[model samples]
Target chain A: MSVVARLDEARAARRQKALIAFNATTLRLGGKTIIENLDLEVRPGEFLCIVGASGCGKTTALRLAAGLYGPTSGAVTFDGEPITGPRREVAIVFQDYGKALLPWRTAAGNISLALEASRVPARERSSRIEALLRKVGLPGHADKYPTEMSGGMQQRLQIARCLAQEPTTLLMDEPFGALDAMTRQGLQDEVLSLTQTSQTTVIFVTHDLDEAIYLGDRIVGLLPHPGRIGIELAVDLPRPRDQLATREHPEFLRLRRQLFDFIKATEH
Target chain B: MNRAAILWRVASILVAAGFIAAWQLIANLRLVSPVFLPGPDRAWAALVRGFSSGDLASKLIGTLEHMAYGWLAASIAGIALGALIGSSRMMRAYVAPSLEFLRPLPVSAIIPVAIAMLGLTQGMALFVIAFGAIWPIMLATIHGFAAVEPRLYEVARSLQMSRAAVIGRIALPSALPDILAGMRLSLTVALILSVVCEILAGLDGLGQWVLLSARAFRSADLFAGVILLGATGYLTSIAVSLVEQRLLAWQTAAR
Candidate 1:
């Protein structure tokens, strides 16, 4: 079956409840409250962008949603089930900037590793690996190592690896922060087009306000230290976004400035 | 051919021969007794005599047997103990200090205790050689385990690999360079200890041949045995280095 069909089948089975919910949650690390009493939800097929300064627990919130960590006193749930650990339904792209690939394995093998773990049929794995690599604009680079690839290419390979699971929700933690400004824009557009085409739920975290406004269906602005939702703004721009025109649109620029002003004014 | 380079090489060897000839002539002129010194030709004659008698063959074979057996035992024990220490955090913590303390003690010192316990036998000698040889391999494994980048471990985790799988697939392959380097180091020391055991213990090996020649005042025999020992040491080291290169080709390719 195709990835969309398989994901649709999975989501169809779990459609009665929200895909993710964080209910009055708090996360404590070494007895320091990082994020406290934060309530959040990611509906199916929603492109949610989380924006905050460094150390604002934006990444913490993403980790909590991805089931990498648990709330200290509250709940982080997927399909109304409390998440104890990472599962196949959710995959994370860490901000560690694409160094997460096994150097021993080529790009094709690295992308196919998850499928191997999931016990996907050996007869069909090659095609899926190829399709995922192609989907991420890395069709002919499958034999290269992560080290051989550039920052943008490595991130794209990580994307392919993430997509190998055909996950229902993608948790991207500053995934493009290391890329150049131009490459970042191009990748943001690719992310927008991919999400819109596939109807996959994405919880993207980024430092740039312009990036959030350019790609988000809804921008989740977070304040520093015990991070909570500082402001939630909806970007009404049409999907299948072109970077130049969409970014130049009056609504896009105005929304970018307003979020920047909000972030600037709200932090202590 | 590079004519000038070849000429220079020939000149250097001739210079070396001249120095040796001067030493031989000076010694023969009563500057030093012939019993205390032998020329190159005398050393060659002694080598031929030992070979024709068929004793050197058996002695060489015996020495090789000890070296091979001891090396095998040391490698297996070292890898196992290294894996155990490298794999477990608590075991590593408790074991680290003791390994540090024991690794520096001289291998020859253990000979007296070994002889006291097991008597003058190849078993005791082999055991001592293996014991001394193990620390390099163990430390290689430990340094490799400790020095592996945290990024690589996280990559293994993200790949959903099992812990044992990580060690087998990533850790060993990554640690191979250091492990081979350690093996090279330990092999040299093992050779020396083998000779030391043979000499001090006066067992029927090349070391015994050297002592016998010395006591009999046969300078040529002493030089012959010494040359053979040097050749064996040099040849064994070169062979191990070649094996190391083959075993660690992937590391060089990565670089």
Candidate 2:
């Protein structure tokens, strides 16, 4: 049985609020179709990963979901309301975390820039920033500038900065794709753990199939040329998954191969 | 900023003093005329005498007031116009050719017309100085705005900040360093224009004093006026630089 079917059989039944829903969405730019007829629904607090090739509109779809821009056609609803332009309930973490986090600001101040922008009260902001920094294992480094920190620390700071909004839905566009392997592993675990605590719905984009399967509750695949949903694979792996066990799991390898084949097939 | 740097600075000063001493020896031996060429000591005495007699003290206030007026006018005009042009390509296109045409014409070339219209007034000098200084400030501000990275704008867009907020926060801060650099360049134009205008018109200024002494063949006083003018130019730049450093503390650290 498939992961979803097996999950359904184990649970017997299920009902939950939909966090994000996209219906017959078509995104076009200058006569070129990017995402066409993409329809999907994400459950509340689910860790969803999107896997696709370059120029398959994965980033564009993520942008639409975040409401940076509206769909060229059809609807993308977040928390049951049609998204228009950047919602306060939503926050996006980018591939270039360095640029998104203000360089001039210290690690704590960088995180606070978002809060200040949002008009979060002063005392609460400081306490929240302190908590977030410590949560990211960057307690003493709070006063250090972004330039003074390492690549991994910078990425972690970006995560902390995004979390300043206390956002319900976190849209990340290849957040870990730029990091070194060790740093990537550390951050993936940090993000995964934090997602559990915050119950933040995650719609993450990546080209890495293994990463998609490793981190996602459901791995979404997209085909190129007016990109449409190709495969929807639910990851039924147990929680509190150790990195080694998760990577070495037979099911993980099987799902990874399946996603790899989907992407490889598209090149032909 | 440091002990080693201070020592090196003093060493350079000592070297300059020795050169001046050699010049004094050469001039005293009649290789140069005291009428045409005054040595460092003579010029220094002339400066001291001028200061004590208040030849320079009163004139300096008037000159400084003129510079401030011109500097403020240029800053306001350049930043406002440059920002408008920078924000709109159509405005840039319409004005750019005209600016390019005007930028090359020496500001000093307008001295006669300025004198005719304003009649040797401080306003005339201020007008000339502002005209001379504004071109670089405008160009730099425009370039700074135009050259902002596309992704930064994407961040602002994603934040859903209002257009005005984006300009006030992101655009202004991002353009600040370049704007300061433009101010530094324009500082030169302001000082030079003021000096040139002062000399041409009947004025109570260091420049006017220098011209008056030059005609009277009071070489030491002329040289002293020249030295004082150079000092003022240098000091104005240094003051702006200090202000730049304080205001742009974030920028300096990034670099």
Candidate 3:
């Protein structure tokens, strides 16, 4: 009945209606256990960031969620259904932008790849591709090859191509890891606004603590050597986050510090 | 063009000129018997005569037609099989040994077998050309497809693209640079094999013309035919390289 209780109730409902969840997932790759007894729940429209030191299997976990890889045991589910393979509505943006986009395809052509995958009618593809490019702040760059663009621009182009799928969930694997700091921040804000406006659920994997706090509605830190969730922190930062004010906010600083300490402790 | 490119071009022309001048000097001074190797001028005169009499034109057309058809057939067959083998681990395992076994046997060796089957006809020449040309293309395409970054395949799978679509869009384009390079290599092989086939079978081609002129002791005509073969090989390679440039301009620009 109280404001706090009402908010708690809303949170419970969101948890119940999770968009993607990993249930006691175990994954073995090349005879080595990569992930063990991992459980995660991602609510619809929630911006969740997974963070850890290198080899923590955060990206592997994201891959499990995207159905790019199946678990060695247990299940990854979407909307209460088991995920056996990549779904058209679930799109991934890889960290290696150089390898992700087709070198032969122009920026527009790259976006058109997703459109074509989803089987959007040819007549509607041009306008949709244009709109996605505009959304990602890459207007008029349709003709530019991925190799010709700057790292930041290429990342944006990648994001635009993913958006062309009009995916319900965006799974990014350290998508901005290669960008310069300024460009990283710029893309962070752009991604925040775009995901916010689209109301798409996001499961972003990054090693950066500040990035986890800045963009995530919740943060999940995985401990390495058979990766499993060690900490789960809810970020209550205000929406429409500002680059200057949001990072400087007390709660954001607290979360960032906590995540950093957790990571530092886990590194050993 | 950059200074280096222009300088290289000039350097190449100078090298050719120097070689020709030396050959002329050797023949004019009778340093080597003219019967063994005719002078450049004598060869040129024979080339003019052959063209004017239209013997060279008809032979050149026959060679060109055979090379073109054989090259095209090999390209298509090689690419299709290479893609199949490249895409499947099972297919690669099953097919690779036979491919390796067949690849190393010289095309010249196959000429006798082809003659036994096809009886020294044009079919025999076509068979040799196609068979010889296919290996480079197939192997290169297989290597290219296998070398595609694993992440790209992940991207394709994540996009939920159909198997056919994945091969058509991702596999083929990613392999294109290597494919074109292979095609270039195969073009040379095709030229060599076609000429070899012509010589061995006495078929109607530049190779046959050279053989007949040599037997008849017409050194100038023999030298001219050999020169034309070298020139044709050089020109065809240049044409393929131009096409490769046009198709893979993005690759060059990206680099």
Candidate 4:
């Protein structure tokens, strides 16, 4: 390697240190530790997935990253600054879309909530909301209420609302768990493309191993009972991943097997 | 709209007609003295006479004003205090016990106390009606606001919503169904208390009109005043139901 190439590589490595970090984070609730002495770093614009068993505190970790909860004994930081509370540039998509959505608000109204919170002017709101709705494949359904939409459509509406914030990082807590097989696959690809184009860092938490392998740049497997990282793998699957070709890839299969084994072991 | 619904409506009309016929028969047979139990014809005649003479209209207006003012005051106070107490864990802990202690005490028991404090005046009647009506609305508001889904709060936090915005945009909308239910119950309470207070305070309302007619041995007039009061209660409740239906249209749509 040439001297100039080495210098460029070192600079890139330093820049990739962390956008969000949980430094020795420990969270206790109701006299029981939920997450214990954890350390995790997420690179900027990386799609990181955390996959584990049911009681592995994966959602709790996502909540911590979203700054919805404070760690009991350690620090969670974003952009090298300690996160004290929720920020405008960080949007979270919850698993229970029904509860997360305002039932009274229409689809357009729901997406406008993030814009309203950001204090975007009223005139600019409608146009921006139209673009978001179109982007999420919910065009011309703006006036429809969340109750009127299918489960898959409602989840898509939720993503649109989150995207309205134009977030730097997106935190998703098992968002596809309630969806059907076909709907989940469609959403998986939609989210992948959305985040890829926006270059938004994502920390997606789920129990499905194949989903983690398909969408993540890096995958973290968590252990239950005082939740901590059990295994970590870097997915080298080619980008612009195809649902068929990517899952069929040898690397993807190997990572899926490794995660499945880790999850099964945690059950014991 | 449907077979069952049409059948129910027809059944209700038949029941009302049967009641009136039975009442008229008892009067015609002289089972009760005319002075004690007037016929439906006499009652209906008295209603026409009172309304045409404009006496009953003014009395109705007075009673409605009292009920409306009292109900409005109760609604405002109940929702404000409920939002405050329900949104805070500390407030719920501190005030909930006192509220529980006071809630079950029959509102009628407070009539004499209200009369003693405010005297025999419209103010006393207003106070009594408001005091009686406030409980259901306030309790409902508290329950509604407190029972808001926890996930919605998380969404608010993620959106970086302020405390006021959370209460206004999220908590208020979520709690509206409960609040509206409470208000409907409160409206009935307001109407009942309005009559009671007007009777006790000798205020210019249907209650006072009925009491005066009884003293004068005008049984038909007394019955007419009562029918008018019943109609008022029915109409007001229907009005509240209409408002609730409009506000909670989404709930029904979801179903």
Interface RMSD of each: 3.1, 2.2, 1.0, 0.9
DockQ of 1: 0.33
Instruction: List the lowest-lDDT window of 10 residues for candidate 3 chain A.
Output: A1-10
Alpha-carbon local distance difference test for all models: 0.81, 0.83, 0.89, 0.91
lDDT of 4 by residue, A135-170 (tens): 999999999889999999999999999999999999
In candidate 1, what are the lDDT values of residues B1-255, reduced to their tens digit? Answer: 599999999999999899878976876685777888887778889999989999877777777777777877888888778877876678889999999899999888888999999888888988998998888988897777766666566545545667777787677766777777878788877878778888887777788888888999988999888888888888988998999887655345445
Local accuracy of candidate 3 as per-residue lDDT tens digits, B21-126: 9999999999988888899999999999999999998888877877887898899999988888987878888989999899998888888999999998988888
lDDT per residue (tens digit) for residues B1-255 in model 4: 999999999999999999999999999999999998999999999999999999999999999999999999999999999999988889999999999999999999988887788889888888888888999999999999899999899889889889999998999999999999999999999988888888888888998999999999999999999999999989999999999999988877767
Kindly report which residue pairs in candidate 3 clash with one another.
Answer: none
lDDT winner between 2 and 3, please give it.
3
TM-score for each candidate, following the candidate numbering? 0.82, 0.93, 0.94, 0.95
Error of 4 at B167 (Å): 1.1
Off by over 4 Å in 1: A1-16, A112-116, A119-132, A139-143, A192-196, A266-268, B1-58, B202-205, B232-255
Candidate with best TM-score: 4
Tell me how far candidate 3 lies from the true structure as C-alpha RMSD in angstroms: 2.4
lDDT of 2 by residue, B158-255 (tens): 66667887777777777878888998899878877877778877777777888889999999999888888788888999999999998877655645
Report per-prediction Cα RMSD to one decimal.
6.0, 2.5, 2.4, 3.1
After TM-score superposition, the amount by which residue B106's alpha carbon in candidate 2 deviates from its true location, in angstroms, is 1.8
Which parts of model 3 have CA positions greater than 4 angstroms off?
A1-15, B2-4
Model 3: residue A264 alpha-carbon error in angstroms: 2.7
